[model samples]
Target: MRSKVLITGSSGKLGKRVLEFNEGLSFLSPSSKDLDITSETSVNKFLNQNSFNTIIHCAALARMMECEENPNKAFLINTQGTLNLVNKVRDIEKSCKTNIRFIYISTDGVYPCINGNYDEDSPTIPYNIYGWSKLGGETTVRSLENFCIIRTRFFDPLNIPFSESADDIITSSIEIDRLAKIINFLVKDEFNGVLNVGNEATTEFLRYISHKPNLKKCKRSDITKNLNFEIAKNASMNISLMKKILSS
Candidate 1:
């Protein structure tokens, strides 16, 4: 039987793109309707039924506006939901003696550095509820010994139009295909820890949106002389760790 790699939040934009990477692998993607990750019973029951060697946690409450508007809902899905999955994985790994690689997709939003690049060692001081919830999920993933958490920034998804933002934040942005390729590589490698994954170079949010050459770009500084968002000015990760894996 082919080893199964299960992806949560398969209905989301990034998860859908990951399915199309065609990297000679088998993946099981469960839509939110099929898998209610927020429910502990649902998650545990599903994992029990399916045998998987890897779990890619892509499910998250991603809307910044919604998080700000209804923080309770965000906490339910982003924090507690993640805990449900992580705890289940830990129990299975302990009992079965099978190495299960758990990869949590994190965001650079957790870093509060307003004007500098952040690495794996950077202090995380999430400035908003959304970032805090994601960090909370990260803590759950970190507690597992056989897991790898990836702190990823904005990467343009395939076939989706990029949204424009004027913040001078620098992050390693890659195509969705590139990210999927890296994920495939991770499954075969012996890496078992936290790592940062992204493109070879750091790019600004404005440049990422403008890459298509058709979308209108707005300067964030012009609209909000005092920026309203609590995003880091430049919390890009150095993709050296990812590069080493890709080169090998």
Candidate 2:
């Protein structure tokens, strides 16, 4: 039997790409109105009406400055919302006698960013509120028996949103379409635990130069001065595990 998949935050950028790449699968892409992860009642109601063997949770309050401005909202949506989903999923799994595979779309921001090439075993000390909230969600996801936490950095290749790129700050960022394809492959395999998914480490400026030639080069300090929250200087991840899994 084909696995029934439920994808939250289907309207977002990454979610939309995941949907596009995961074609021909039995997917339920519910809008926020149809299923709100923040509300336990909403999650329960949706789960009761629909049965899915897999869930790809993509909903999160991701902006660093916004999270700093309203920590309460960030916690409510990213942390509490994740808890509600996990709790309800656990209940549904128990009652239905089925194992639900949870795929959590986490971030590389969980690390302190003091150094790059962070692996799955790296120490998690978030530099900002956004990272803290995501780390909180990671905690809940870790408690689950059958779950995969993917910590990745991805951006749209066609749409480079920024006019300037930081030359000093580096990341192991992959194009969103490529990342989505990898995610589709992983979700079907018998892989459970945290996986770091991205490309070779590169500076923000070099990464965007090809796509946006007119983009101005700037240092981390230039960008950080305008923002109230702290940002990672080097958020690159070690993708050896991801490569090994994909190869096997």
Candidate 3:
């Protein structure tokens, strides 16, 4: 049977790219106005009315500085918001007696970046409010019988929003288009649990330069020193699993 997919956060960058790349697939990309995920009634209403076997959950208040300023709002949308969807999915699955594949877009920020090269088995110690909020969402998704929590860094290669990037800090960040492709693959795969998704460890500046050679370089402290909260120092992941999946 052809899978019917429902992609949340369709307006967002990653969500939009996912839709663009998977043009051949049967996808339902709804706006927040049409389906507000933070509202239980709204989510339940949408899910009940729509018939889909796959869910790509990408909705979250992911702004790091904003999350730091208002942690409660972060948790409300990220943590409680996810719980709302999970509850509805469980209900739908029970009533319909059909499997629903849930693909959650998580972050490498959940790792303790004090030491780099963390894997799926690594201890989760978030450095900032954004990280903590996402980690909360991941906790709820784990309860679902069929779910995949993808932990990775994602950045737009065409649109690097910053004039300068950190040279000192390292990450396993993947391009937005590639992220969309990989997630689509996972949606069809039998894989579950956390998968570290990204490229080899490289400085943010180096990754940024690949697309923007003229971009200026800066240290991590140069940016974080002005901020009140902490940022990931070296949140690079062991993406052997990601590579294995791609190769297969």
Candidate 4:
């Protein structure tokens, strides 16, 4: 039988891409309006109605400024909301008596890199409520034995030109399409446990923005560092794990 994969936040950028790539596969993609992940009852009802072998959690309050301004909402959705789903999954799985793969989409913001690159084991210092909330969700997912927590760092394709800002710290990023492909691998249990995925090089925001000739340049100094805590001058990731996967 084909695997039934359920993806939350199907309306978002990454989720949309994942659905498009796996259009042929058995997928249950639902938007936030269709499913309230923050509500236990809603999650339970949805889980009960659907027989899914895999659940890809892509739902969360992710905008940095928004999360900072509304910390409560962030916690409710990113942290507690994730717990509700995990708990419901555990409960539903008992009667179903089938193994379910729980895939969590996490961010690289959890790491506090004010001066350098971060590895899988690097000390994580979430500089803002958004990061903290995501970390909280990650902790909840870790408690599950049959789960894959993937930490990704990338800016979605804005379609606009990348602006050059010298103060902008360089970080490893993956194109949305590329990241979707990697997630596809995980759906098949290809990798697990705190895997880091991104580009090998740490590219600056300005460099990326410059790729678009039509984009107007914004002064690096004009860009305000928007985080509660300080990070490394060069906070990037080591993509050896991703390299091994591609090679195999």
How close to the true structure is residue 131 of candidate 3, measured as C-alpha lDDT? Answer: 92
Please list the C-alpha lDDT of all candidates, in the order they appear: 0.75, 0.91, 0.90, 0.78
Please give, for residues 114-195, the per-residue lDDT of candidate 4 as tens digits: 6555778888888778889999999999887688888886556655334444435667777888899888877875466887
lDDT of 3 at 103: 90
- lDDT measured at residue 115 in model 4 versus the true structure, 0 to 100: 56
Q: In candidate 3, what are the lDDT values of residues 1-248, reduced to their tens digit?
A: 67789999989988889988784478998898888888998999999899999999998898898999999999988899899999999998998998899999998989989789998999999989899999999999999999999998899888888899999999999998999999888888899899999999999999889899889999999998899999988989999988998898
Candidate 3: regions farther than 4 A off: none
How close is every model to the real structure, measured as TM-score?
Answer: 0.88, 0.98, 0.97, 0.89
Error of 2 at 210 (Å): 0.9
Question: Which is better, 1 or 3, measured by lDDT?
Answer: 3
* Clash counts for all predictions: 0, 0, 0, 13
lDDT of 1 at 182: 73
User: What TM-score would candidate 2 get against the native?
Assistant: 0.98
Residues 13-127 of candidate 2 have per-residue lDDT tens digits of 9999999987556799999999998999999999899988999999999877889999999999999999999998899888888899999999999988879999999999999
Judge candidate 1 at residue 220 and give its lDDT: 47
Q: Judged by lDDT against the true structure, how good is candidate 2?
A: 0.91
